[model samples]
Target: MRLICPNCGAQYEVPEDVIPQDGRDVQCSNCGDTWFQPSTQMMAEEAEARAATPPPATEAGSVDAAHTREDALQEPPQDAWPSAPEPEPAAAEEHWHEDPDAPAPGTPPAAPPEPEADPAPAKRRLDPEISRVLREEAMREEALRSGRDSLETQPELGLEDLPEDEAARRARQSEERVARMQGLDPAPQAHAAPLDRDRLDPQPGSRRGLLPNIEDVATNAPGETKPATPPPADAPAPPARKRGFSRGFLLVILLMALAILVYSNAAMIAESLPQADPYLSSYVAWVDQWRLWLDAQAQALAAE
Candidate 1:
């Protein structure tokens, strides 16, 4: 094969070993111009191949051309085509089948036309009064959107003066109220109509579901209790326990022997009784009562 550099008009012979007869690239060493070359030998081979293979319209017959070349190179199946036809050489044109995803080489893209500059938003032709009104409107909107537009100082706590227990109780109440509002348990039942205050407040002395009052639960006079001016709110509540009672049962067992002293000793005598006597009956009755007590205890446990 041969190549001619158009710029330098120098011709270079292509290495036959590298230049396959099929369409391939050949570069002019002088000008570095690259062009495609297709030889006559390749065309003849292609024609002979076409004669051996099935029609290209069939799915199996339309395999890659590169694979056909591989078969010729590796084994060159005798019954298969000996050669293939080459296409006309293609010139190194300025344009190619460009991938849509790529930008063209060396051409500045249209500058997107600068969006026509928008004329600087007309320079805001407002008088001072209008400008002030717009500024105030914007500020008002911002404040409304962000309720915490201004910073707030936290409530100051005094180590010596602040009432710790009261503060913690209030905090707990606030958190629970927030949780209730956000649909957490124990959720306040929504009413079809506004509920009366009486429904929400507990009756005096009723401890059904209400937690014990802190002052009452302290169970000791504030003055008498010198642990701290206020007990640590985070401290465990004094182990609230009620005295419990346990009961045990015992059976009265008695054994007796009688002797008749002849004369008036013929009255009456109780002999040996069977194992299943009144003693067994009494034991069974005691067990039944104990079982009833256990059942009551179980019910109490479940309620707790």
Candidate 2:
């Protein structure tokens, strides 16, 4: 049987039994076009039906019938054959078609709506007293921080506030103090002139000069002066030491006095304080035992 592709007019030859009685789909090897091909039996039946039809009376009708026969023999029109049913649309596509707001096919999808920002968390109300305390604490901390920053920023010893000469003198004095603390002698100044020992000596009656006393200079180096220590103030006489019994000694004395009192007034104690009766009886038993032991020792000595 011969099969013709309607799309590209390409033809293929195959066995008659390859197609079913109804029809079978066949593809063109040259153009890759697929179409249904009727079986040889069905084609034969169709041809017989066409032949049985009455002949056309007019010449033009006969000519048209001949052309139709030629067309059927070459390639049948696609409309004459039953077409495959179309596939059903997807559920979502069907819904989209029903919705009026759906965008037309090939149109870009609308941008997704931005998420709404969450509402700001509500501030918790605080007690007036607590708020005031917190505010004051914050202010105090801020003041302390500012004070520390100022202290760090400002020059130590307030050198910026002093005259240049005074500042230099103070710096030198600080250096000297540090050197002394470290048990080091201060370095001599390059600019200072050497001191004249003879001129520096103080006269007997005149007021003391700018230079230190001769004895002090003799004891120490010329450039270095020992820091004068303040006189020791008379310490207040130490608080009078109160002579008193120590806690343990006083406790022992109190215990001895209590024992004597209990022993002398055992009967009165038992009558006055009923709670002391049991303790009094135990103490009396202990005393009696001790006396008996002493009597036994005396007897042993007499026997020896």
The residue-level lDDT of candidate 1 at 196 comes to: 30
Q: Least lDDT summed over 10 consecutive residues: which range in candidate 1?
A: 247-256
Task: Kindly report which residue stretches of model 1 are placed more than 4 angstroms away from their true locations once superposed.
Answer: 40-304
How would you encode candidate 1's per-residue C-alpha lDDT over 81-153 as one tens digit per residue? Answer: 5677665456434445769977779977756655555555556567989889999999999988788757668
Model 2, span 1-304: residue lDDT tens: 8788898887777888889999988888888888788888888999999999886679778898999999889985567678897767785576663668778899999999999999999999999999999999999999999998888454456434544343344445554655454466677541242322343224544424432355543455535666899766985766977656686788899998988888878989899999989999999889779889999999999999
**Candidate 1, backbone clash total:** 8
**Candidate 1: how large is its RMSD?**
32.7
lDDT of each: 0.56, 0.73
**Which segments of candidate 2 are over 4 A away from where they belong?**
1-235, 238-247, 294-304
Q: Give the best candidate by lDDT.
A: 2
User: Which residue pairs show collisions in model 2?
Assistant: none
Each model's number of backbone clashes? 8, 0
RMSD of each: 32.7, 31.0
